[model samples]
Target chain A: MELSQAARLDQAAEVLPAALRRRVLALPAAERARIEELRLRGGRPMFLLGPEGETPLPGTEITAQTLETVLEMASRSSVHTVLDQVRNGFVTIPGGHRLGLCGTAVMDGKTLVNLRGISSLCLRVARQFPGLASEVLPKLWQDGRLESTLILSPPGAGKTTLLRDLIRCLASGLGCPPLRVGLADERGEVAAMAGGVPMLDVGQRCDVMDGCPKAVGMAALLRGMDPQVLAVDEITAPEDVQAMLQAAGCGVRLLATAHGETLADLDRRPLYRSLMADGLFDRLVLIQQTDAGRRYTVTDGEGRPC
Target chain B: MLKLLGGLLIMAGALWCGVSAVERLRRRVRVLEDLRASLVWLSEELTFRRSPLPKLLEQLARERSGPVELFYREALAGLSQDPEGGLQQSWRRAMVLQLDFLREEERQVLVEVGKTLGRYDAGAQAQVLAQAARRLETIRAQAGEEARGLGRVYTALSLAAGAALVLMLL
Candidate 1:
């Protein structure tokens, strides 16, 4: 069975050093469910970043050894195996929980070779909201074909969570005809793949290229996987836009996410503006975190509010 | 008849003691050689394939045998049993428990290998494993030499001790 949010929090905590794990797990189930991230810094009190605010766990001072042990346990004692991710300053655990690391950088001629002497770890618990795309999915289709769509949100606004559900729904044919989705999961966050199998359910027809750079994986997926849709997270690089444009040229629809609160916000960035000028995406879903809950707004390519 | 039987028993006991002494020396040499071979294989795998430590240890346990196999199996078991203690603790524990035949110096080489196995990048780990294999090779060479020399001495000493006892008794 898939784990509940609180259970996932507990599962992520399992990788923490023993004492910290116990302290984090001791929270009320309600509080555990609300936690978004866990921050542990050497010589500082550990804090749980929840929806409310940063809640510090008093008297729990993190040490360098604690950070090392957590990394060791999280990597299953194979830090060498995940050195590529370590070089990127974060390591994603099996269940898609991401551990953002802070440490002294080991460099090789302007390149980050690895991270050593870790001082802090921010563990972001990955949650699956399977039905989050239900309302947003119907609006993305025009006639029999799905439109190229882009999900927009500020960081920590559940953009990845929504993208994951959208892919699952599209591939599973929950609300639309099932399409083969080629996911370029650069950091392994979208699929949380382990040994060629996704730890999280992406869908029956989803083909994930895990831990590959978005631009390269998308091109490879387009060439080999014959995907009808290419879904990528965080369109941050120019190479990623070029790849997406190439895929769109082949009539393969795209489902991608970008860091933005609104369509206007995306237009301010030269990279996003150029992609928009190409008319690559026909639909945009902007996610806003509200007092009540998260609000999803679907807009046309022209930025007309729905 | 009783005296003849006692003499026979003395000779048989002496032969058994001599054989056992020779076997212990041979076993030590065999163990060291096997361990060195396993480390070499591990180093290659880490450098080329970059397989995870647990999976590699599992493969080592499955394909190998004797003290080398036992050592890997115990280390793998340690990881599963008490993961919070991490690989270093598990590896050190496994070495202390399973590598009793190794000299203090030989075991110390393994202990150093344990400390670096999973803590660094593939290049670093591969280098450490290669160094360990070299150290083990040196130790095994010395052990092989000693086994050839000391093995005969131990057998001969046991044989002489047994003969003298039998002579006194007779």
Candidate 2:
């Protein structure tokens, strides 16, 4: 069967495996050609064409049929699952595609149950953008070893992307000996792997526990994996703090991310506040996006410019 | 013949109530399923990549469509409109909005989720999740018992009314 236009786009970014990409792209020329044309033009053009090219783009255009098909195809080809179906309009695909669905949602108090007449879907494809860690690696390895680091960024600022690249660099030993890395991919975002193997490189030296809760995964890694460094994504819960502390206590250097626009943003959050107060992380890295590109800034635990 | 007419009326009423109750239950189940799916999505987005929590939360809020959208919208509004209110205040407002829509058990689960997001600790978050799961189990058991009781009552009422009508006719 022919892959949908969204699958084609995912293939281009290498989010879809090579074998699957070929299978998806190898359909009859007419269908493949249509998706290729749309892929070349990007999300906006494909969106403009609408499903079956019958009508103008509605406010929310993803249909239930489209979502179900895409999801089923992705799941069949990959090891990921559908984690959540948002009532307002989104289906959280396991390998990190937040397919924004457009529909009317039925609500019971604060919780939503069903979405009817899905109109549009924005499939946010997840990719591990490499080459970022090279810039920050030197700063992190102060004395010929990896230092405990904290990555800070606003949403979509690419903290996970950078961390993934860092893990790859450290694990593969791009230039140096491979380092054993433990990745607690609590959300299945980092590896974006289908089964056990990662769709993204994320380095050869890293052992990943996908979809496991962060704390349990971390403790497991410490006890079982014996990783040289421990990495996790977004720390917001107080329990996550305790886990990080526990990992630190185990003598495993920490690498993680937190939400904040600036160092001052850290002061307002209790978890970040306590981590900062305790001086848990040896180095703090800030990422900011600009028209030029993503800029990285290094800082100490005290939030001083490094 | 008069007695038969009364029996028919009673049967009609019972069927009507039965269908209505079934429909209500179905709707509730659908809502719960959707909410559960959304929660899974929330967990994925929050834990997947290392996006900053506030930024991620704001993005989620912007992308929110269902009932929880309001919570996200309020969080976004609080962040943008009341920058001085601080993260805690913004978070609290969002949680409050969420609490309004959630069942008591779901609300408790969210409170713990909020706490986990506020801090960067994984173990603590896991603990809260385990506790919430336990509470959910209790709620499910109670709901099951209540549903069973309701079903029995419905069956008894239908049978008793049918029997009484037959006797009156005889």
Candidate 3:
């Protein structure tokens, strides 16, 4: 079978330095296709993380020089264009590939402005598995409309992947009335936008506002786009919860994700605690990576199984 | 007829040597001037825009349009081929290869500029670029002074030598 345009191997290989690229290219074809991330740290062995967990790339040692080369290639030699993302600790390269950065913080009057002495990097492959949300969508929608929904999952459990599919399905009106979806992509993940263009299929009716804070983008979409459903990822900040509440108050449907395994975990966070008690969300979907793909459990706002 | 041909040949040989010597000095001056202008523009760009290194290098390659462009273009190509060498190493290799006419001091200053490039905040990078530009300005002045004297001497000496050779042949 031919490779899809989005997953063309060259895009993934571009971020790697010469030594690492050779190492990655030598992996079996199936293992190469399943690669989700390539993690590099100065003075440590390289690692490849996929669905099968982390596998170390032995005989490879990341160095300060290796990181400099990756930055040069990934940022296209322009540090200014990605300075904001650097300050935020990650950058989204072309082809919708996201690179996470870790280095010494450069402070501008107590606020983190950028990084220096960068020593660790994570190059994540942006893969879209369409229709992953098929089974979970019916639970999110009830009586022919999307309820204010929240998805919960642990880190690396495919929360963003599921969210992307869910947004596409709902916006395409899987079996219901077609509705406009406003995706406030804070970290450029949901839509994986590059040059203001959406790389992943978020659906025909989805309008995205990316590369800004989720709260700010959400508020902007709510005021300007007048979307029927607003989606955001990883709502950990109090400001994001405020924007989500404001969207709920405006009677717009909410679709969002948070870092947690169970509804009980979300109940512990103050921000989510208020959101839960106020009934801002009507449905909760929890995801766990299972042997047979991902397993999702559904419940109502009051913690009752759907 | 044979004597006349010998005289013309001697004059031609003298003219070629003299002109080639003068041209070499003049070319060095042009190189220094072009590099200085490019550095000034780079400083301004680094101050205002603070673009990423690869992007800025591509832009410089396009805008500078000569040996200056060669430096960036070669650096980009080298980085693509051997990224494990680091950005500084790639850039240094370009500078050494492309800026062969440059004095060791002038080349050293350019390599220093690479140290802070793409590795610091805008203010810091701009500061480094500005300093490099200043150093390049001084080197350009030094090259200009040397080129003016040497160019005139080589051209005058060659013309005189050609005339003497022609007279001797006659």
Best by TM-score: 1
Please tell me which model should have the higher lDDT, number 1 or number 2: 1
TM-score per prediction, in order, is 0.95, 0.50, 0.83
Write down the lDDT of every candidate, Cα atoms only: 0.90, 0.62, 0.81
Off by over 4 Å in 2: A1-8, A12-81, A84-120, A175-177, B1-170
lDDT of 3 at B156: 79
DockQ of 1: 0.76
lDDT of 2 by residue, A1-306 (tens): 223445534454232223334454455645543331111111232232222433222232333444443433333311112323343244435455445555567676987755544444444555445666888877887667777899999976778878888888888997555789999987676776555777667787898986667888888888899998898988868888898898888888889999888888888887799988877898999998777677999887776776
The best candidate by DockQ is 1
On lDDT, the leading prediction is 1
In the order shown, the candidates' DockQ scores are 0.76, 0.01, 0.37
Kindly list the per-residue Cα lDDT of model 3 for residues B19-126, writing each as its tens digit.
787777777777777777766776777778665566667787888767877988998788667655656788899988898877789888888887767666677777
In CAPRI terms, model 2 is classed as incorrect
* Rank list by lDDT: 1, 3, 2
Which interface RMSD values do the candidates have, in the order shown?
1.2, 15.9, 2.6
- Poorest 10 consecutive residues by lDDT, candidate 3 chain B: B79-88
